[model samples]
Target: MPPTRVGAMRRRGLFVSGAIQRMRHGPAPGRWILLIGVSLVLGVALRWCGLPAGFLLGPMIAAIALSVAGGAVAVPRVPFQLSQAVIGCLIARTITLPILTEIGAQWPVFLGGVFSVIAVSLIIGWLLTKWQVLPGPTAIWGVSPGAAVAMTLMSSAYGADARLVAFMQYTRVVIVASAASILAAVLAPSADGGGAGSWWPSSVAGRGGTLLVVAVGFVVARLLRTPAGPLLAAIVIAALAQDLLGLKLELPLPLLAVSFAFVGWGIGMRFTRSTLSHAVRALPAVIASILILVLVCGGIAVLLVVFAGVAPLTAYLATSPGGADTVAIIASSTHVDVAYIMAMQLARFFAVMLTGPFLARMLTRWSGYHAADRA
Candidate 1:
């Protein structure tokens, strides 16, 4: 096969692997419906049982992680991972200049988190490659502060092994989120530390409408092929629209829980038997590469917090190199600066998108693999 064709074939496997995973792990079609229905029921029960606010994503993430660990369900496949690319693309429509200005205006808080994580991800990638734990391209992309899904997709697009990318991306996020949540619980500044944290709008329905708007905006953004930056942007715009229109957005708590459950289900679908069995033959290196990246990026976040003397907790929350939106949600429950987290997350995202391919090329040259091998 031509090198390009080889690349394409590997790229195609990203989706194929996921389907095969489902076939092996998932129930028959009739059972799948029953499982999904049960999931919805459980999600609703959890939401109604007085889970803390802004924690809908937590349950879903837990479901995905638990399923993978306990073997209750198949690991998600590449197609499901690819589906998030569409979500990212559609979410691009959320951007507006006002939203940029909103976050950019908080320059000091934003820049601290952004540069800190970038420096960390870069240094970590270099170290893993030096240690021979990972191929350079895999290490570079693995440590990036961008969206987990985005990193995986870009890696696939560049002809990196789809299974490795998916595993590393999801694993990093799982570690980062779990660790951050625990740390924040133990060490977060008392809720009353500052002026009682600013009051969030009480209108749940209005908020849900904003989410609807964001979802709609994403569709348009994807159709336009706009970059993914706007997913948060669209949320901001919708928030603005809600305020301007004085529309009180009321979100049903149970409904919110189900929404995130779907997202988790989708995320879980990224891995399967193939992803673990054949695909993970090379995972020892990949896992080592990721652990090193975490330590490095995490250290940067700690340093940034100390240097900035910002609320170490808030700065730390904002600085961790996880997904923009996911991090923002975590910060919300912990009462960190939601805008700051969102901003820093976006900065890291653009950083990964712009640099992932170049990193892939550099690693290929250094590691004895042809760049063309990265499909």
Candidate 2:
């Protein structure tokens, strides 16, 4: 009775399906252009607003939105690895002989503070798992108070959901950075006078050397096949070169922006609807854990004030569970002892980077054992 109508309907359905498929996979150039444009706009806006890691966060947010809306575009592996290496080099540039000496002078204080943060992170991770908020070691890595990018990449390497880890890491970074900035304003309003330097490098030689180090680091990481090997290798090599050989490592603004975009896109494009939903649901617990950490670290800061005789702001900045880069900015903008805060932050960074993987594994196992016992 309706053969022609049915045939026409079938062809229309096929046409719609083909169009959807083409949109997702065939329009590569258009998708890239759109994604890059959106990323740039957001990145610039956020940077202008003075948010921490604004470039990275902007691209991340853009990618997440596009991904959830079915316009996802993937970042290639080589670019992502290069991005990680670049970030590693950036971290390395901050590790100078003076920072090392400072840490060495107060080894006990550094040790206690760094371990206290790590232990609290472990406890939070364990509780997340016990509460069944995230699966396995993902919770452990998510709550680790390390360099956010480092934690996210390392967690992905260890088979945790990088998307979720990135969510947790960046969320805490934003919160902690904001809190530190507020505290800085409240404590020393007169000291907030520092501005960022020029984005271009002063020396071409330094930039070349930095690139060479990153290339070597990439190769070494490939050889080692370790989790986040590229990043770790770059950090070690660049730090050695900078501190021991007195080489200046420079990461220009443009280069850093592209690298940050690659990393942000890499994490953002991996999100599926399911992961996004999980992240949304787990966000409350994540925020709660972060607040608890901040409070506990504040208590630690008070101890530093009383016993170590450090300035309150310096102590707080040093102990704040945010990214080292963000903390450095806050320290610089305020009248706090920038070197001391950085030293403390770097000490904690190294400690977390060295022990994070082992702790994640141990906690995962421990959590699993408890789950089995309950069963």
Candidate 3:
């Protein structure tokens, strides 16, 4: 073509090549930094918009996107424990003498509801095993409707596949969390704009006392090796101090948001390609099982609302098939009775811990017996 046109094209090519080379050798930001920075920005934006569980959900979604895009990222266990401590302390603040009395008064309803949910879980577990949807012991442990960590830990002792148990448990957690956030939005859409934590406490005595309580809780939890030890210890200690010493402790909203982000990161970072593939393959069966559990729990909640005259929100939160700390966070966000919901979850947690192993072993025997009969 023309000489001037050819020179222009050559210059354009050189410019493009220079840009590519710079990109290859440039001081680009680390992938981890980009991932974290992006997640924080998106999460805070969502929180500002007043979405239900926005901080947690926003970070979780961002992390999931990065993980799927092959980003090398990880969340340490210490952050997970710290997140639990933040939530645990928040929940403990909601407990009171009146709420404790209410729980005692409603003991019959609470016990019946807990037992019914366990029975439903057991039946679902059997169906999954019977249909070969999941392995017998994994199904048994997975469908226990207890704390995921506790159930996963219990699975090994009962000869269940820990990996499968963990997979199922976390699946339920994700589903329940997503559903609860949607429900919270539908039920309570208003923003609550108070109670941010301060770096400096209002009083020196208050700061010292609260710090002492938290320190003791962590130390005690570590010694015990309890599942979710930090949370359990914090809740128990904070609750006792509130009742006995009339002490009140509060975490600033900013700190609480950070804890939520940490928790979301911990969960999302667990989603490797292999795990994601297996989850997709098993999605239909797992979704069906979890949906059935949710429906059954919802029916129980409705019954409590009608027969026991409990508040609808309280009933629903009480029977929610998520973790206790999760239930507390959702309940608090929705302005519900955190103590009552927590009480119900605590009851279920203890019951599962007590009966899960025995039941899993029994189910294993039943499965073997049935297989032998078929043979």
Candidate 4:
């Protein structure tokens, strides 16, 4: 109320404002502030709209808009890594002994389905090259039905257009994830079996045990040079501990939201007008290939339903063409048979990761195309 008090309050306010500006601007002020502020605001707004995976969608859209506008923005790796770990934890919690037993019993069916998916994906790739929609290697890598990021990273080495491949791969992820979520909402409203909770253990001993498992997982995944390292590690550790050791670990809702936001932002930030224009030009071919793959995989799902005796939703999930990470999230959110879907997705992922390079080379050579050496 007095002059001294008012002066002091003003000084304090200025100090706080300066600190915030420093944080928002980082080393470079104006653009970074805009990027962070817009992303945060949009992410929250999307979450408020009750959108499934709104946290991801909002930030992603914001990042894409900024990128297209030629704004300099990048989501650092730490947020993305934390997100991966959170998702890994969420996925690990879904695995259980009963699910493992069920999957083990149906190994024959899984084998058949995995083979079918690979065979069909290759066919789609061939079709793209035949139509001259893309180059041979790009077509192959673009339509590989593997994890988007992994496949994209491998694309250049295999003589594919890495930018084009990334565009195609991530676009399909967005489409498939959106469509699957919508379908689940409409057809299986009760599928979501999870809700918010803290993953921390109650006692110090429990906390130590949980951390130990996660740390071990992180180390193992890194050692193996796995893509999405922390996530894969977390999933492996969580699942083994839960199923074998009867341990329970979970990620809280807020943490899950933040992770989703980071992953979404990471994908969206890859876009620019040049890359997007290229993607649009190739959209017709890409969409056709994806459609064919989905339909063929749908047939595989039918077999899963009839022979494996799982629900139609579960069958469809097991055979979803891409987005293994997204599939796990959808499975958990919709409460579809998590174990079965994850098992099938994992089967396809490993198959593609282990054999994708060799197969790409073979197919290119067989088609009378030489694989390019960029390294």
- The most accurate candidate by TM-score is 3
Give the top-scoring candidate (lDDT).
Answer: 2
Q: What is the Å distance of residue 107 in model 2 from its true position?
A: 1.0
**How well does candidate 3 match the true structure, expressed as C-alpha RMSD?**
5.5
Tens digits of lDDT, candidate 2, 95-141: 67787686688889878887888888889988888677776677889
Candidate 4 ranges with C-alpha deviation above 4 Å? 1-51, 190-216, 371-375
Cα lDDT tens digits, model 3, 268-372, are 665556656656666688889899998899899999999999888778878988777666666767767778888888889888988888887787677663434
**Candidate 4 lDDT for residue 55:** 58
Whole-model lDDT per candidate = 0.54, 0.75, 0.75, 0.73
lDDT (10s digit) by residue, model 4, range 1-375: 999999999999999878655554455456556666776787666445433555566666767776676663678876676567667777777788877887888888888888789888887786676556787678889888857889999889767889889888877777767666666666565312222345543556545665566567667766787787777788887787878887767455666666776787787888877887777778888887777777788888898888878799888878888677777666666657877888788888889989899987777776666544323
lDDT of 2: 0.75
- Sliding window of 10 residues with minimal summed lDDT for model 2: 189-198
Off by over 4 Å in 3: 1-31, 193-204, 369-375
Would you estimate the TM-scores of all the predictions? Answer: 0.67, 0.71, 0.85, 0.82
lDDT score for residue 203 of model 1: 65
Better of 2 and 3 by TM-score: 3
**Regions of model 1 farther than 4 Å from truth:** 1-109, 130-132, 157-159, 187-212, 225-230, 242-249, 278-285, 363-375
